[model samples]
Target: MSSRLINEYLREDKLPHIWCPGCSHGITMRAIVKAIDNLNIEKNNICIVSGIGCSSRAPGYMDFNTLHTTHGRALAFATGIKMANPKLKVIVITGDGDCAAIGGNHLIHAARRNIDITTIVFNNNIYGMTGGQYSPTTPQGERGTTAPFGNIDKNFNLCNLVKAAGATYTGRSTAYHVNMITKLVEEGIKNKGFSFIETLSICPTYYGRKNKKGNVVDMMNYLKNNSINVKAAEKLSDEQLKDKIIVGELYKTQEPEYTEEYKKIIESFQKER
Candidate 1:
């Protein structure tokens, strides 16, 4: 049953969301709502932006003002909104293929600029909305429609990549770890500069069957069994950590936010004029 808090955030007319049974995207969506509730953020002041994909469909069910943009361009549109009105909190909801593949360039540059946007990437490891095709985050050797013989491409460690690109806050959590996901998301939103979170989600319809990963329950358990807390990961060697997922905050640092910096620049120019 959806909690009172969750129901308050959703559009009741859009009840029974479109995601397939056993898909974790819905759970991830709830986590986002839970976090926002914990922070007591005014829904009207928040703008949710999404790119094209199954993950992108989320905005339609949300009651807040939202933008369902073109493939891989959610971040670009979000950037514009943030710059135009820095007081509005811009939250980006995107999928693995939408963010890591097509939108990767925008993702990195946004972090580098330290824009005040909270980006939540639903990393299901495959292209769930489009077909069961391999995506930038698909685990090596996992089967996809495009890789019927098992995938050979290397996967991206998105948190690490974004941290390197200069996101002020970076974290990871799974749909199975609902409370943890909620906490991290709240922390990310409170952060002053760009914040990027990667939520490892399940696409049981596509990723699971194609990879011979039993059922939804089994897949959810896989996340619990394979994950290691970042504190404990410090003692493990690279080889020892190869297949283990690292949970918790990976990086955070203070920086001048993009919009604030732009405001300063404009004021200085006006003074000179």
Candidate 2:
């Protein structure tokens, strides 16, 4: 279905979006909405939360129960939101800086707890909203305003990071892989425990300009050419997989979710009392 027709599900007055042309934030937002529609979740039952940075503008454009919180604090706020109600389907939208930099602690603990929430990291590889600063996921040897000499720091492999932190569902996809992205988001929403989706989004105005990546199409093509499936990755030597993009669902498992465990403890305490 056309995105315009899907507009019936959105709050259109909020439109004339704030993102630059070819930016993938809108695509990510649409993918989430499409996932929600596919899941048949009640519109009122889902809460979309966001942190500061360009990607944080997502919740503002979305029509669901939304919260635009302080910088790098969306996970903390989302945790509280999930705990208090335990019924709300909370989804946190954050940028790479917001998730892996200042919010690093919150991100890890939330995953460690297997919290019943979905975290979407819009990793455009730079601090797009704040003058194109280098971020934790920025490619090594890449140029940024802060890394004019080329970034010397290693980037975080978000999929492995979240997997190690114990997220029940972990996956990676790029804005270029729209079908896979939409599928993963849908699966994440339906999953009971913590779900982490790292979308390699495009920031044409900032990241593109700094890296000579040109336009959104160029970035998308880069992702397309570089991507490999997890199954295919197993056969390639470590050297061959270096700097290659791995797309598709990386890991998933069934585990007791945080809310369920929390509730069981509360019930047991009440019985003892």
Estimate TM-scores for all models: 0.97, 0.97
Best by lDDT: 1
Model 2 Cα RMSD, Å? Answer: 1.5
- Name the runs in model 1 displaced over 4 angstroms: none
lDDT tens per residue, model 1, 148-190: 9988999999998999999999999998888989989999999
lDDT of 2: 0.91
Q: Which ten residues in a row have the lowest lDDT in candidate 1?
A: 1-10
How much is the lDDT of residue 198 in candidate 2? Answer: 91
- lDDT (tens digit, per residue) of candidate 2 on 197-234: 99999888988999898777888899889999888998
Backbone N/Cα/C clashes per model = 0, 0
